[model samples]
Target: MKKICLIASLITVFALSSASVNAQYYFFDGDYYENPVLYEAGVSVNAMNSLTDLGGKKGIGEKFLKDLNLGYTSISGGIFFSVSYKNAVALRLEGTFGKVSSDDKILAGINDAAKNRFNRNLNFRSNISEVAALVEIHPMYIFVDWPAKETTPPRTSPYLLAGVGYFSFNPQTKIGNRTIDLQPLSTEGQGFAEYPNRPIYKLNQLNIPMGAGVKYELSPLVNLRAEVVYRKLFTDYLDDLSTTYIDPALFDKYLTPQKAANAKILYDRQIVKVAGINGKRGTEKNNDAYFTANLKISVIIGRERIRR
Candidate 1:
């Protein structure tokens, strides 16, 4: 009976020791997921470009990045606040301010395929202000090897994001020394009784933003990131040129005399105007889009909790 009690006590001691060791192991090396909430704030500098009807690379205008013109790249900036879970997924609210412009004259004398665009003589610049809510997923974070506590989340992570955004733009063009707002001119006879099929587009619209990026931890509290986000827009009028040219006389019937005069010259800037109604002003098949490449710096905020 004494021997039995001694053996049982040894077993109890061994079990207790194993449990204690496991708790310590998890506390020191495997508690990365303990935090339910994490906060971060950041700012970014961006290079902006637009895929519109105005300017493009030589050849017939292509779709997406193939038609990008480097000369028109502009600068933009943004700020963001985010909340993350287990370092694997994040929800972010971001605001961006920027300018985008393009000029078809860039394609002048490039090729026969680009002649029509060069002769079109359309150009525009617009200020962009956007607010977006996005979800970012870090796939690599879930596969972390967790070799040690200090290296659990790794120093670098690649992420993809998709979100909806609200943006406003006012397309403007320079005529001589004067800047003209294109939307108010009803350039394509929009909202005019003569062109019942064409409706005026809103200056503010919703867009879908999707992109990928990579982040590197510069320190425990700071991170550096680079990303390219493409905004898919639903309107072709972002550059103030879409559909066929309206007869100049139509402007007189619908607009004030001063506006009518301005519209006549701004709507058709070509040296040799294409006669009649079928002259294509801009391609209507695809909507316009813009993209930005950003370099960002972020700081982690809020207290971190260590699991017990």
Candidate 2:
């Protein structure tokens, strides 16, 4: 993570330096009618958690799961540099980083044997990180003007943004004497039994980001922004858990009657129930979603058009 952060910082610095050199050619030559350079930094509070009892038979109750929710409301900060052209359009480069967690009492049900087998404690704990970049457009701001004479300034400017970003996440769970990886729990049945003493998962994913927000200009050079974004991930194992109990009919198809009965006992305490989209367990789907809200402050670096 530190290496990734260092690389991001270098990229941002290079971009700003390159932009500064290019700005003189466009602005000094009077080739553009309007050009406003902006730089911003701010912090955000993230209320991130999951809905419980998402899908199963003999699963955690919906209300109990919801109430046992655990996660972090963290303050994330970022820096953005952008340029507005002709007052009608703009382009921005932004990088944001924050910490998020998924802790819940649902982990408490795992027995000592299960914990030893999976190498995780199953207790609620904070363990995750996030980073993203976005390209934004300021459409409605074309009609709004900054107040130059007012003692109190206007506090809002609505805008919309859509873009793609790369993300890296590390989710972990505690078992007994050691902390184990949970992302692999989804596919544990395949080859996990062989490695009973090691961490089971190393889950990582790429995220697709999109959202909208409003900005308030605090001064000619500084502004505040509040935005909400939904991230669509390419993986289905964010929770690093699963519920795979065998139904009589399901077992009848794959196992002999005697084997089926034994399998029930083996899985009785092994499966982790996940609620479906419709609030019922054992439905067709078994995936989850992630969302976030960010607040930021930015500064205007330079804004002036020179005569050719």
Top lDDT model:
1
Per-residue lDDT of candidate 2, residues 150-248 (tens digit): 222244667777655555555455444655443433222312333243243345445667778888767555677788876766544455444332233
Q: Give the TM-score of candidate 2.
A: 0.55
RMSD of each: 13.7, 10.4
Across 1-308, the per-residue lDDT of candidate 1 in tens digits comes to: 34334533544454344333312122212323323345679999999999999989888889888999989999999999777755677777788999999998998777678888888888999999988877899998666634344554567899999987889999999879999999989999899988887898899888999999999978666889999999999999899987888788888998999899889889988866663575788889989999999999999753333647
Segments in model 2 whose C-alpha atoms lie over 4 Å from true places: 1-47, 50-79, 86-90, 103-126, 142-155, 184-187, 190-202, 242-286, 304-308
Candidate 1 lDDT score at position 300 = 76
Which number leads on TM-score?
Answer: 1
Give candidate 2's error at residue 73 in angstroms.
Answer: 3.9
User: Candidate 1: where are CA atoms >4 Å away?
Assistant: 1-34, 144-151, 303-308
Whole-model lDDT per candidate: 0.81, 0.46
